[model samples]
Target: MLVYFRLLSESFRFAMNALRNNKLRTLLSLLGVTIGIFSIIAVLAAVDSLDKKITKDLSSLDKNTIYLMKMSFGPSEIPQWKREQFPNVKYDEYLYLKGAMTNTDQMGYQIFTKSESLKYGSNTVTSVNVVPVSHEFIDIQGLEFDEGRFYTESEANSAAPVVVIGNEIAKSLFEDSEPIGKKIRMYGQRFTVIGVLKKQGSGMFGNDDSSAFIPVNFVRQQFGDNNKGLVNVIIFKPEKGVDMDAYKAEISQKLRAFRGVKSGEIDNFFINVFSGFTDFIDGIISQMNVVGWIISGFSLLVGGFGIANIMFVSVKERTNLIGIQKSLGAKNRFILFQFLFEAIILSVIGGIIGLLLVWIIAMILTKALDFEFVLGMGNILLGTGLAAIIGLISGILPAISAAKLDPVEAIRTGM
Candidate 1:
């Protein structure tokens, strides 16, 4: 064990000497490994950050939540023209489903509208996301409040002129002052702020921090119930541990009966499950992983070749040293390990530099974009392990050749 340690120490010194003596050659050799590590780790970090953001954004809502709407969230067998012709989900259907559905825990009606500006006195914030939803939306979405409270059921039903703003919107409009009970103008009407959502940062779909929520009845009243552009959706949260297939079947049966659809005809509305959407996202992430591996694999291959080339040159340079060591009764294993350790040290150093670069860039991006970019321990371990493996594979043949050299022939040739 002590001899092995001495071998490692000597190999490390030799590796440092190579770097000090041949600066440009060593740098050129290390560049491939550095770039290879950077590309792979950067791609992985970005993907992981994206996956985390998606998960965080959807964390409040249940995975079994279902959205019933005229349009499909994912691809559907229903033709686009037919889907377009389908009538929007009605408030009556929302009410009927809420009362009749047995497998549901919470259900609500919501309308996703285009961007609208809000005015507080002379201060105006433009292009803010406007969400008009029923009182039950709060429960269905599991929304957290920073101040005050969501509008009451009576308030939602009566089309009350009250609104709940996000943390960013509140800060933008009110500055240091309290936002609750302050009236803001939207759609050319005054609405009293009732609640403020907690700071949620940037989201996958949109920034929840800069959005406003109001009663769906208010939107219906303002635009009239039959507006063609308005997309009304009914959201349902299924009970935990329930059979999803049976729950979906029950919903389909109930809606089909309510809509008076006859046998053999396709259902007009689409039922989109949240879990299905997440699964689709997972598939996309998996494709990204495959692409990253393929693209970065080339870089790693070039790096491996560069290391192999350097190891061969190192063996040629150290021919006399190996001959002297063997003449002093050093074993074949010692000679082989000396060269292998040098190769590994060089590769690992390059990889460390690459990882450092990634960490710095990740920090800069996280601050610049206000999105968290993480470099987890697992990825770090994987990068280091890959570097070592590359070095070992590249060093083997050169190490073997150096170990086999006849001491007399090697010494004579070097002289």
Candidate 2:
């Protein structure tokens, strides 16, 4: 055991000597592995962070939540003109579905509107995401409060001029002073602030930090049902464990009958389920992972070649040393292991540097951006293992060739 330990120690010293002697060459050789490791781990960390954020944002909400609207969230066989001709889902339909649909848990009415600006006294916040939703949205979205409360059902129904601000919005508009009961201006009208949502970091779709919620009735009041610019959507949450297909079919039948569509004709509107949207997002994420591996794989390949190149050069330079060692009765396995250890050590060192870079960048990004970049332990282990494997593969042939050299011939060739 001690003999093997000494051999390993000797190999390590040789590896360190090579790195110390050829600083620039070592750096250049390791650069490929460094970049490859960085690329791979960085991509994985980013995707993981994004996936985690998406999960956090959607955790409270049910995956089965459905969005009923004229526009399809994903691909559709229906033509553009036909989709355009489809009427905007009306507020009445939202009510109808609430009463008519079975296996429903909760329903909400919302509108897709452009970003709006809000003003409080001299302070103004621009590009604020305006969420015009009914009172039920609070329950549907499982919204939690920071300071105040969501508007009452009567307040929403009566189109009361009230708004629920987000944490960032409250900070921007009110600073330390109380925000609830303060009046803010939007659409040339003053609205009393009612609630402030808890601070949530950036998400895959969007964040709640800069969002504001007003009653859907407020937008409906602004632009009546016939307004072309207004986009209305109906959200339905089905009861848990219900037959989704039948539930959707019932919705389709009722909506079709209401729209007066003839038999055998396609339904004009779309019933987009939230699970499908998430599934689409998952597919995109998977494709990104594949692309990252392919691109980073080239770097790893180049890195492997670099390791091999450096080992070959090392063997040539150390020919006399190997001859002397062999003449002194050193075993063939010892020479092979010496070179192998050097290759692996070099690769591992490069991988460690790459991992450090990733950690540094992740910290900076977590602070710089709303998104968090996480470098988990599993990924670290994977990177280290990959580096070691690359080293083994690159070092084998050179190690074998060196082990086979006859001492007499090698010594003569070196002289």
Candidate 3:
């Protein structure tokens, strides 16, 4: 151990002297390593921030709730067959499911139809999303009204033209006016506003406060196709003590029966529970990990090659010093360790400097992007390990040549 420490110290001293003598070359060699390490750190910081953001967004949904929808999470190039496979869920079927389910505390159906233009006085907003929902929608979504109450069941049944505006809609239409009792026009039809939702910011792709709410029947009357209703999603909160998996199984069977699917046939719809969404998110993160690691590895590979080139040049420059050491009765292992240690120290220092740079960049990114930079012991260890590996591998051939040198022959050749 003592010998190893002595050799390591000597190696660092020799490597520093060589670097000082060839300052420009040393800097050039280190450039590749710097860029590679920087890329890795930047990616880790950005991805970590996005991960936290996604987790926060998803946490707003109750763990016990399940979503019944036509689609799943994560980007897919496959085109959706929204109309053919899963026809829009009907209002009667939603009611039937609610009545039939004994394992749910609350159940709600949502239907959304977007009007391209919504106007208040002279100002207009385009591509405004309109959602029509039952009072239970709030319960299932775990939402509390910020202003007036959610519309009553009687209002929903009577197709009352009362609307609830989201924060953005309220701001756009009413500005400073008291939004309650105010009227807005969509597709030339007028609706009275009864409430306004508080601001909930953007998550993933869509903004939370991007839609206006109205009673289900009102939406059906205004926009429903053939009076059959076109429900987009069904959300349900599980009752206490009910096993979610069992509930899913029972619900699947019931829905299959309702839809008249054969035992051999796959159900056209999907059921998304808390775990399903988490699993989907995990899959996406895993893919990102693959891409990140691949890019980082490639960069390290290039840096490793640069280190090898510099080490080869270093061995040639130090040939006479190696011969002198051999003449003084140094062992081959000693000479080999000297060169290996020098290379390792150089790579390690470069790695540390790169790590520091990336960490600072991460901090800047976190502040600018509103993301958390998750730096820990693992990342530190990884950077150190990578540096050592690059140095050892790059120095191997040069160290071997130096150790095998014949002192007499080296002196006689004098080159």
lDDT against the true structure, each candidate: 0.90, 0.90, 0.77
Segments in model 2 whose C-alpha atoms lie over 4 Å from true places: none
At residue 193, give the lDDT of candidate 3. Answer: 84
Candidate 3 accuracy as lDDT:
0.77
Q: For model 2, how does the per-residue alpha-carbon lDDT over 1-415 read when each residue is reduced to its tens digit?
A: 8877887788788778888999899889999999999999999888888888888878887989899999998989999998999999999888888888888889899998888999999999999999999999998998889988999899999999999988999999999999989999999999999899999766667778999999999999898887888788999999999988888899999998888899999998999999999898888888998999999999999999999999998998888888998999989998999889889988988898899999999999889986778999989998999899989999998898888888988888889
What ranges in model 3 sit over 4 Å off? Answer: 1-24, 70-83, 115-118, 144-148, 172-181, 190-194, 225-231, 261-265, 325-337, 349-381, 403-415
The worst-scoring run of ten residues by lDDT in candidate 1 lies at 71-80
- Writing each residue's lDDT as its tens digit, candidate 1 over 1-415 gives 9999999999899889988999899878888888889889889998999999899888877889999988887788877888888889999999998889996888999998899999998899999999999999888877888998999999999999999999999999999999999999999999999999999888888777899999999999988777988899999898899999899888899999999999999988888999999999999998998899889889888888888898899999889888998999999999999999989998887888889999999999998987899999988998898888888888899999999999988887788
Give the better candidate number (2 or 3) by lDDT.
2
In the predicted model 1, the residue pairs found to clash are none
lDDT of 1 at 20: 96
